[model samples]
Target: MKKPTLRLRLLRSFLVILTPLVLFLYYENYYAIKIVREEVSQSTSNVLSIHITQIDRTLDEITHYLLQQIVTSDTKSAYLDMASLPETNGNYTLAKIKIHNELTSGSTAFENFHSFFAYSVKKEDFIFSRSSFTDTNDLKEMLGEYVREKVKGQSFSDWIVLRYWEKSYLVRVAQASDGVYIGAVLLLEDLIRPLRGLDYGDRWEAILLDTTGQPLTKSVMSPETMTAVNRKLVTNPLAFQVFENPADHKDYLLVSTDFKQAPLRLAAMIPEKSLLQRLPFFQGVIYLIPLGVIVIFIFYSHYLRKMLFSPMNSLIMGMRRVVKGDMEIGLKEAETEELNFLITTFNHMVSQISHLKINVYEEMLKAQQSEFKHLQAQINPHFYLNSLNIINSLSTLGENDLIKKMTEHLADYFRFITRSHRDTITIDEEVRHIRNYLEIQMLRFPEKITYNIDLPEPFSRTMILPLMIQPFVENAVIHGMEEGSKPFHIEISAGNCQEDPNCLEILIRDNGVGFTPEVLSTFNQKKFGDGTGTHMGIWNVYRRMRMAFGYQAEVTFLLGEPNGAIVRLTIPAIGAFHEMEEEEDGKADDR
Candidate 1:
């Protein structure tokens, strides 16, 4: 079996030691940090709730005081009477003076009162308090614009906080019984007085936000810090949340609580550094543990690389050489038993592979030789049987002159076949053999058989396996002859094929009885029948050609013109002696 790779071994070792250590450290740190954050958030939330409640109560008092001033004032009835009278009436002037005195008295009665205005919708006139900073025209325009734009068309009275002259104010708008709009404005700083009095730490900041989440009091923070806080409020409004500030890359806990009596949110922001500083053990040991763990991991990794990775790198190099066909390579034994086992196994595998390759090569040669001898044996009996049959027919006729000529041709044909122990012969030699056999057949048939040989000189020297073409010629002569001497004509021709110039095409055709439908289908389907005469001859030729040239050889049978058979043989045009010489040269180089 193959041994585990060095990387796998090192990973196993590291996981056994490092996994639990890392998990323990992570859990411990997470639990401790979680406890600290929860305690801090809870404490901060409680304090911020108290401050928010105080601010809510203070605003409630302001709302009650504004409502009382509007309800108890006698100026409300006098202002309605003045708006009902004409501009020229003497009582209108006296009543307007009385209303202005009441407004001035109400504005000064409250602390941090900015201004108060009473608008008569029917008369298009505004009455201002003495404490108003702007002129009556500006106050009238401001009040008219506020009613038209901010209040829209609603007539209900409600308290709202707004910014005027770059300062926040708590404003209450009420419609008096006389159909006049009365507005009272107080500075927002006064409403948040209780929150300001609370003792938040130096690192903590308190803010009062209006209903729209805008800071009501003046902000002491930089623009970037305020922007970060505002972005957090957008996602988690009216809730306690913690986030990291982009400006300083430090964590801050934001505790936000909504005012129960007003549309306002109070927030307290405290830096996490200050909160963690209050913890007993977070300062010293929290940093040292991770640093020590990192140091240990570094030393452990270095030791593993020295003992494991270095040896594996050598083994990898040896494996690459083996892949490149150098099976003789072997790695030296490593210090560990597992590594030594891998090296020893690799060496033994290479040795066995070398032996198997040699055995496979020798077996391939033996199989080829055995097949060649078998094909050679198959050729002789078939040819000899036909020759003997011809001789027997001649003797029965008692035709000595014709028999003498047939015997000479038969001797010449067998002499050529026996002379060559090699598998291949030149096309010219094969054609000569076919001519000898045809001459013998012509003697037997006399004037009934006529033959023609057409061979191009260029294709005469092309190599082909022995006994390839003679079988087809023999078949045509024997089975294709007609009765009553109807002139059986056999034509043998060879040339280089036009489509593939490297290949030779030899055609043997006869002008005699053509193949029947059944026989033609058998040949076309390449299914040879099991018989001793013509069937075995054609099958032997087809098998030998395929074995010798592989895909380069083709044997086809067809009907010739004027009702006869055509046999075509296509094989590669390689010279016999030249191929033999090349093979000898390759063998010498190998040695």
Candidate 2:
């Protein structure tokens, strides 16, 4: 496993020591709050139960009177009896008036009732009723089918909360024989209105729900409280739940109870803040313990930042500066022991890096010098004697002009070979040396050799490996020429390579016999030579380029269009690397 940094280790240690105290205080506070919420919730739920019971008793009383008057009397309701008789009967109108008066008189005793009605199953209409708000025709339109379904000899139904004519009511009905229904309906709001007077705390609300968990009354509920009550009612409808309101952003205790005589649920919502307001005075002192821990934790964090992290930041910045090649930066001495050790180690590392950079640069310069001297050694002494023989043959032919030309070519060739060794020289000097050697070949083979040199003006002074192109040209002349009726042609061309604006391309092509398939395969695989000294010049050139500019040296051998060999070389531009080196050296000088 990787070891942790000093900052990470220190932070973890601090948290390990601090966490248990925080959790203990938090648990104590949580335990006390839980105890207080339970007590307040129990008290509030009992009070809500009593309120539900009061509503049930009031409904039960109204239903009891209706049941007795309609079903248990010695006579069925007079209006119900008259509904079964003919409309032409003499007592029909009188019975209607008489029974309506009785219903109105009975309804006055229960002032909470919105209405009372007796339905006539035979007539399919209400024959006795007490409601001034809605006329008999409107009542028949609303409750006509409801009355018929309820009075089919069933005794009664539990009070069901219903919405009628845009108003919610608590409706209870009792069947009086097969032809009559005596039912009482009181507005549901009137039944729950007493809840507003009861106190849990300010902004408390109550909602009336049916057994299916649908709210029948939203009057006392704020939209936020009603939403919370409904969501809690889904999971557990008969007990208490706590929920947070999104709109008001406060916790509320929801108290609910099932009704025995009514098909409804009574739920009340009181603020959790109010419930906690009833906590004992000692709880505040308990709260201060956790609060004090938070204050200490914050103070410790600030102290750690100043003592440890601030110094660590300075070390990190110094490391970044070195990575970007600024080797002159050093961190200040830190106050802590661990940080001081790290800073001293860091400063030592940077010093070692500076020394290593100088060593590598010196080694590269020595390598370049050794490769140039190696190229000078590659010149064959036999070739010098061959040039002398060529000059002797010219003299034997009694051609003074050709002899003078051959002597000058031989002079130039040997002069270039014996000159002082340089790591780099101009493209102009290298090209001049190549031209002089090719001219000596033309002098020797006047009719058989012809050459073209296209050296553009722009790259003449571009610094490149000394004698870089000469070896390849020498190889072409020695290995590529064949005895032919057609004149052998050698073409040397130079231009910019696309990889960099300063990168140069040199193409040396010859109309001579190309390599056999086996030799081409060896070149293609980059196995430049066998164990013997075959293709030594090509091998030497390729290795020297790699040593200097790395992979930017590209040498490719291809078969020409009909029968010649083509050597194409792409080498890196050296100007940019040297310019960067110069800048680095100048920075070192200033430091």
Q: What is the lDDT for 260 in model 1?
A: 77
lDDT tens digits, residue span 314-431, model 2: 9998989998989998789988899999999999999999999889989988887776566546643535665677778878878788888778877776675565334566678788
lDDT (C-alpha) at residue 507 in model 2: 92
Candidate 1: segments with Cα more than 4 A from true spot: 1-35, 47-205, 209-216, 220-239, 242-265, 269-350, 356-360, 363-367, 418-420, 497-501, 524-526, 529-534, 575-577, 581-591
Error of 1 at 575 (Å): 5.0
Model 2 Cα RMSD, Å?
12.1
* lDDT score, candidate 1, position 550: 81
Q: Give candidate 1's whole-model lDDT.
A: 0.74
Per-model TM values vs. the true structure: 0.57, 0.56
Task: Give lDDT: candidate 1, residue 150.
Answer: 44
Report how far residue 102 has shifted in candidate 2, in Å: 34
- The CA lDDT of each predicted structure is 0.74, 0.75
Off by over 4 Å in 2: 1-31, 41-273, 280-310, 380-408, 416-428, 457-464, 498-500, 529-532, 546-551, 572-591
Best by TM-score: 1
